[model samples]
Target: MEATLPAVAEELLREIKKAFQETSHVPDELLLALKFIFGSSAVAALDLVDQHSVSRVVSPSGRAVYQVLGSSGKVYTCYAACHFCTCPAFAFSVLRKNDSLLCKHLLAVYLSQAAGVCQELSVSDQHLASILLEEEEG
Candidate 1:
């Protein structure tokens, strides 16, 4: 049976709270960002489950792809201009922040990409890519 939206949402919230409670080295900026994202009902909706997957794939142009499997058993694909996550949290994060990182959806994607288990994982986002580039340059 599929999980209801509220159930998934509540589960996600527990995970976020547990993550926050267990972290000792979290940066102030990250903590603030977490509070801002998880603090809101809309954003909180994204953290409702613990089961998911992430994978990476190479593009024709030689770029990495990222895929996310949401707790609701939905898949989201994001590659450059074609980014989509199965969870509403991903969209909520983007819509809520003009310039912020460390959202739960992004975290999920990053974890999935890092784990190398996503399908057709060749996905990228300009916004995320630019951040990586900036970090490299800095």
Candidate 2:
């Protein structure tokens, strides 16, 4: 079946925003690409996250918990959290680049945090599995 670009783009934008809200850094080029692909809608969503201080958290086994701030001010809790963005663009890039290149979520989060979009968080990872598992279930 032929996929709708707008629908796909919308999904991509949501995932990117989710990832950004939960991660610390997003790549610059990826953000630009999102803007190019999704335009103002994507930017507006990102702006909301930034305004709200949403954060992403990640906890990989045997690593410290990482708290990531999104460009839109959303916060994610965990260690190595970008692994969870759920954005097609990010998934494609990770699959195509073998995780070598940074994804758009990472770029957006980085820019957002740098701009003081939200508060900083430092947490431990032993409890991160629950967070990751929760996402998996959704």
Candidate 3:
């Protein structure tokens, strides 16, 4: 079956977000990633994280998801590799214009992974459920 880029991208995005949210305490790797995205001080990045704005989430299948919590309490999945975000800023400002700009959420995930903060979570029946569901639904 042909891989739907969005789904695959979502899977990757989920994992990255999950790592940040669920990983054992925030490590230097994650902080480093934030620095890259938010700049050397990393104050803004920490602020976002401290506020629980950016986090890792669990999908219905039990897979870890990378998500950014909006001010409105809307959680958006993020795909750093594809520079995609399921948020209004992305959908309206970027997608509507057919632009290829990366949102802050995407940048955070990318920098976190690149800095070695996030990791590929181990697959489990509970977590794998989401992955399977995605395959079935998509």
Candidate 4:
């Protein structure tokens, strides 16, 4: 039972991403399903997507970084490939407490990518390094 839970969730997420890719917008039924699966995080992620807050920053060497401007007006660094996010909710609810699978910002990155709506930017590796080193204010 425990093992099947993650598999089920993964399948659902795949379906959601496919729907977004196919239609460029989530249908009402899919929205309801997302709400049931992700709760308020789903709503917040959708809002971020609507605001066009997700960005894909790529360096000349082909390294890519993802960032999301959260609802709280803070820019969060997200490594979607690694399932990591620099957000308080990710630290508290995902890592420390294990109560959630992802932070809203991370989810937003995934949704934005699936919809092919993320703001893409190309920069030098030095600039990418600067972005990675910048401190986040609480």
Better of 2 and 4 by TM-score: 4
TM-score of each: 0.37, 0.38, 0.43, 0.87
Model 1: weakest 10-residue lDDT segment is 41-50
* Winning model by lDDT: 4
Candidate 1 regions off by >4 Å?
1-52, 79-87, 96-103, 112-138
lDDT of 4 by residue, 1-138 (tens): 112226655676778779877876678887787778777898999899999999999999998889898888888888877788888899999899998878899888877877788999899999988888883433
lDDT of 2 by residue, 66-135 (tens): 3444444444442234333544444566566553233445444533544446444444574566555664
Number of clashing residue pairs, candidate 1: 15
The TM-score between candidate 1 and the true structure equals: 0.37
lDDT of each: 0.45, 0.48, 0.53, 0.83
Score candidate 3 by TM-score against the native: 0.43
Candidate 1, residues 1-138: lDDT per residue as tens digits?
322333443454345455555762334554455465545422332342234455554544566645455555764544432334434555566446533333354455533333332345344466447534543454
Q: Over all chains combined, what TM-score does candidate 4 have? A: 0.87
**Mind giving the per-residue lDDT tens digits that candidate 3 earns over 21-94?**
67645566655554543343245334444464665555445546576655566656775435567766667655
